[model samples]
Target: MLWRRRAGMNGESDLAIHGATPGENIDESVRALACARHLPQPHLDRWLAMNERSRAAFLEIAQTLRLRTGQITAALELLEEISVRDATDCADILAAPEIARIRLHAGSAPARARELIETLRARRFPRLRETSTRLAGAIRELRLPRGISVVLPRELRSDVLTITVEVARVAELDGAIEALAARRAAIARIIEMLGGSE
Candidate 1:
């Protein structure tokens, strides 16, 4: 399909998708970029399926952020899911504070790209994000001594809590053990939270 854009009343440029008929002044700019990046056909189809504003918005993001193939795919899927769940537009999703901060503000592009995906994931899974936040707060509340770490399962996908102690000496190890024991009740609360105990 041919891609073009026009200015919206809000000053936002909107993308145009045209049928792939012969001699229609096709706009291959976006398609060329997608091809250069080796974007998978299925994902490319998904991209093409998005509305004009979303297509333009995502195109701007993909270009500006230098999103890799995998990142593009993940971001697209997350955006699609978020739109379906929230009944919102992809452009609106990209405009969110957390996303816009990373997109419009600056740091490493790779880091921002990763953050963009993660931010979208958080949006897509609000409850999981909330649970993760609460669990992280609980972990911080423990105030375990240095060299001791509380590890929660990735995404809290399972009811597993891993406690690690790093000590260079028997004395340090003993102190770590003591510190953990002192925080046993607090730590248990964290474990209970992980186990869906509330």
Candidate 2:
């Protein structure tokens, strides 16, 4: 599972699993970030101390910059266009055939170009998602030697919870339960910090 940082309303951010079959490490990172966001100072410090890469990814997700309203509106329009077009149509649009004719009719607007690119990206997202899902499934189904486990760590403030699985091979069914357990633990800590419970 690849961890994807998605922009949220009001300049907030959230995490998403890029593939249908999620990875333990990706789940751990998502949980750790959510936990640290509400944890007290010392606990947060300890959480960051667990791993540098984890800290960086957390910060990057937390610090997502907001786009201007105009940019957002343009992006929305692009999304609409993407929704109506098939993959082949999208490719055709991007091929830049009859560039001179297009240039003559479209005029020279940077915003228009940006919008076109955005539309292309929006159209491609579903395809990307499908491909990622297939790859993740393949990875999950791979067989590995015994005694090796994939460790995923979820951190919150000064606490770190790790999910470890002992499996004979890297089959699709392996490690998911342990990873989900760790994720739940991390979420529980985060909720507690948010005044729910310990």
Candidate 3:
């Protein structure tokens, strides 16, 4: 009496309720939550497959943290990856000090939820955070004109850099261009980092 994901001909997942036995009450609650949140069956199955402590810990988090479906899915994925990498359980990962602080953070539920996912992401990919921080510091050191901005590639997945200038007058555009030219050498270093020369 649960939902499971079935890969279809197109290699996409199809959701349907299937039969499995576990802690009946927890399973039922998981099913109810899954249906209510429109959680995909694969995620639901993953949730149910957890040990009782882990399942209960996550369910508690889902309720008290007021997580939405997408957040839950993201949290589930991060938790699994962290668990595998650290050789720990989801319950332990969720209860880590950093996450515990976020859980008790006084911000709005949505803010805390977002921070939780980002914190998990930072923990899962520590080097990415460090690299992003370094890149940001490099940009700050340039101290270019106010309107000019260097856009980092999303998740550092691409080496492309986008520079934009906002100006209301020809004089302002001229100033921005001159400022960009002044910082050309430093900007090239940023490009080198983005190109994985770090």
- Choose the strongest candidate by lDDT: 3
lDDT of 2 at 197: 37
TM-score of 2: 0.19
Q: Residue by residue across 1-198, what tens digits does model 2's lDDT show?
A: 256666556333445655444335544553455454444445444334433343433333232322233433343344335535653322233323332122223444554444444444545475554443443343344332344343222222233323245555566345655454545644444334333232
lDDT of 3 by residue, 39-83 (tens): 999999888888876786677667657889999999888888888
Q: Roughly what TM-score does model 3 have, to 2 decimal places?
A: 0.80
Best to worst by lDDT, what's the order?
Answer: 3, 1, 2
TM-score of each: 0.80, 0.19, 0.80
Q: Give the per-residue Cα lDDT of candidate 1 at 171.
A: 100
lDDT of 1 at 81: 92
- Root-mean-square deviation (CA) per prediction: 4.1, 24.0, 10.1
Compared with the true structure, the alpha-carbon lDDT of candidate 1 equals 0.81
Q: Which stretches of candidate 1 lie over 4 Å from their true place?
A: 1-27
* Rank order (by TM-score, best first): 1, 3, 2
Q: Give one clash count per candidate, in the order shown.
A: 0, 4, 1
Error of 1 at 135 (Å): 1.3
